[model samples]
Target: MDIKKHKIINRYYHKNCISCKSWLPATEESFYSVKKNKDGLHSYCKACVLKKAKESMLKNYDKQLERMRERNLLPGMKKAKKKYNSSLKKKKTQQIWQEKNKLKLKNYRLQRDAHKKHNITDVQWQKCKDYFNNKCAYCGLKIEDHKILFKGTYIQ
Candidate 1:
């Protein structure tokens, strides 16, 4: 393969590694390299170029973070977080109230029915009637006038 293709970017003079100073052929796949210049200085290998670029970038980022801290960005951020949490708490409370009220209404209806002293399950009623052949267990009462001295069994 032609090493020259790597020089598609303008090639400076001889290129070398930044850390070890070992010479390397100019190549495009390199992570960092000197942009071509009229001056005859050899281009740096990708590694040295990358180190310089990263150092500058990190320095700028640190400056930006310092500026933000000075401007009190932290307090504004906390207030926004607090407001979001409060809204979530309110929504949860409303949802819980709705669920509890629904269950309470169901139990109220069941209690009302139980208070009326209705004793027999539909199954029990049919069994009692059939076993007695339509005669009341106690008084031998027939259908339409069926009444027994004993109470219907309702476990609850």
Candidate 2:
């Protein structure tokens, strides 16, 4: 209706984006809020800001990765490293225990083999061990001595 009223309405309701040079509604949805700006809205529209940010991230992707690695802030890197270290420690401990209990492990394997192959129960295997005084039948070597002599070897 009135020219001054129309001008005032357009001035307050619409804004031109500095980056895109497009007119958008002067609202929080169209532009980010900026306390420093007189109109309390960013100069660039939301789309322009997002585009610039994406371009910047793509351009500096490697730099960001290096920075994150340096700061130990890369996602999953720390977790993976920790998991690997713990697993390595666990493996080392298991190897040490296996080394210390070599005789026990050999006896367990013999019993398991006897049960699976000959259908011998644990009590029968124990009786057999007692009959031979826990010595190898062919070699006449004690279980402890056999374990040391034939370390890492599987006997049937």
Candidate 3:
């Protein structure tokens, strides 16, 4: 008796959508899963499925609204809408306030940062400057001379 061996070839599975007739890989990335199908994937690709769903929703828009009304969800939806509008108004008011006080806010932030970095109050810094007669302690340079050299209005 003589025996013969057959070679096996590797092939990737692909399927075509019944509606669009476009070939796509038979995987979740390209197709939706259908448990009843032999390939375990939907007949239509993801894009076709989404398009069909959107069309169906638009076609049944009135029916969907009626269903939502029946379920007593309109009141909750209205409350959510009111809350969203109120939040938007609050944000707009805050933006207006910030725009009106830009210089004041900038000065407050500078003072806060200076206090944090130097651990000194504005009053203490003023008293120290007065003690030195607003001049450099080591070089005895006047505050105006130092300001010209450093290009700063005040020294820390």
For candidate 2, write residues 55-132 as lDDT tens digits: 664566667567766665554577766876688787798678779999999999999988886677889888898999
Error of 2 at 131 (Å): 75
The better candidate by lDDT, 1 or 3, is 3
CA deviation > 4 Å runs, candidate 1: 1-14, 31-42, 66-156
Candidate 3 global CA lDDT score: 0.68
Best by TM-score: 2
Q: For each candidate, what TM-score against the reference?
A: 0.25, 0.42, 0.40
lDDT of 3 by residue, 35-148 (tens): 997667787888888778656655665675577656544444676666766887777985687789999889998999888865779999899989999877765656775454
Clashing residue pairs in candidate 3 are none
lDDT of 3 at 21: 80
**Candidate with more favorable, higher lDDT: 1 or 2:** 2
Q: What does candidate 1's lDDT look like per residue over 33-142, in tens digits? A: 33464322335655566556556544465564456556544334576566766887777974676577998868887999889996778899778768888754543334
**Cα RMSD (angstroms) for every candidate in the order listed:** 33.8, 27.8, 27.1
Off by over 4 Å in 3: 1-10, 72-156
Candidate 1 weakest lDDT stretch, 10 residues: 147-156
Which lDDT values do the candidates have, in the order given? 0.53, 0.71, 0.68
Residue 26 shift from truth in candidate 1, angstroms: 1.3
Residue pairs clashing, model 1: 32-46, 136-140, 136-141
